[model samples]
Target: MSSLSTRFWIEAAREEIQDWENECSYCKRAKSKSAIQIMAPLPDIRLDMPMRAFAHTAVDYAGPYITIQGCGKRREKRYLCLFTCLTSRAVHLEMAYGLDTSSFLNAFYRFTSRRGVTVKMNSDNGTNFVGIKGTFEETRY
Candidate 1:
């Protein structure tokens, strides 16, 4: 731009640069989101629940992290099923050997056995959670 300025005076140079910037793919990609994000109201479980650690909880799966078992070099992928108390902000981590409903059920049973039955549970509609939901629905009269 400094060298170009010596050749001729650019009228509305700022506007011209902005126009090019707006059209440039790299510039457009680099720009941060301009719209303000509106957060939803906090769920009742977070506010209205009793102070018990596992009274109401939110559930999510973390990852299929690599693990080595036994005295061999055998490695297996395992997921972490995270259970978080809404009001108490307490977290309980459970290892899930697989993403299947049975695996999650085992982990869930372990959690229930230790923490007792939760009054309410929140999830992000994950596939494993969906499968467990269907299982519960089927068992209900």
Candidate 2:
């Protein structure tokens, strides 16, 4: 008693024409909204006086030098240098081994504990500075 074709049955059951529009998969995938519009330019910063006006500091680390005669045979030896101020460019340096978070923090504490507080301090994105996740806490002093 069933004489109707599969296509005729599907078309009758759909009840809407919107489902049959734009059958191309590529066209649908390629189509997207317009690109985002640009806003105003970033603001410029101005300094009233020279860089020396602010207590600025720069920090860097040097060397994992090879073992030397008379020096201990340790693989973690390194030098940490901190330069401060612009006029005199006062610098502080210390020798350390095992560049882990505790060692770095101890060295920094020793330096700052003696030299006193500084207004600004800058250092490159090193493991000692940024620290690894779940290994060390960020210092704020």
Worst 10 residues of 2 by lDDT: 42-51
Pairs clashing within candidate 1: none
Segments of candidate 2 deviating more than 4 angstroms:
1-54, 66-76, 132-141
Candidate 1 per-residue lDDT, tens place, 1-141, comes to 677788989998878888999999998988857788999999777888575689898999999899998986889999999999898788999999999989999999999999988888899998888888867767642
Structural similarity to truth (TM-score) of each candidate: 0.67, 0.46
> Per-residue lDDT tens digits of candidate 2, residues 32-138?
55789897753222222244432555667776754454555544445554544433467777666556767676776677677665565566778877774243335
Q: Pairing residues by index, what is the TM-score of model 1?
A: 0.67
Alpha carbon lDDT at 58, candidate 2 = 62
Number of the top candidate by lDDT? 1
Model 2 deviation from the true structure expressed as Cα RMSD, one decimal place: 12.8
10 residues in a row with least lDDT, candidate 1: 132-141
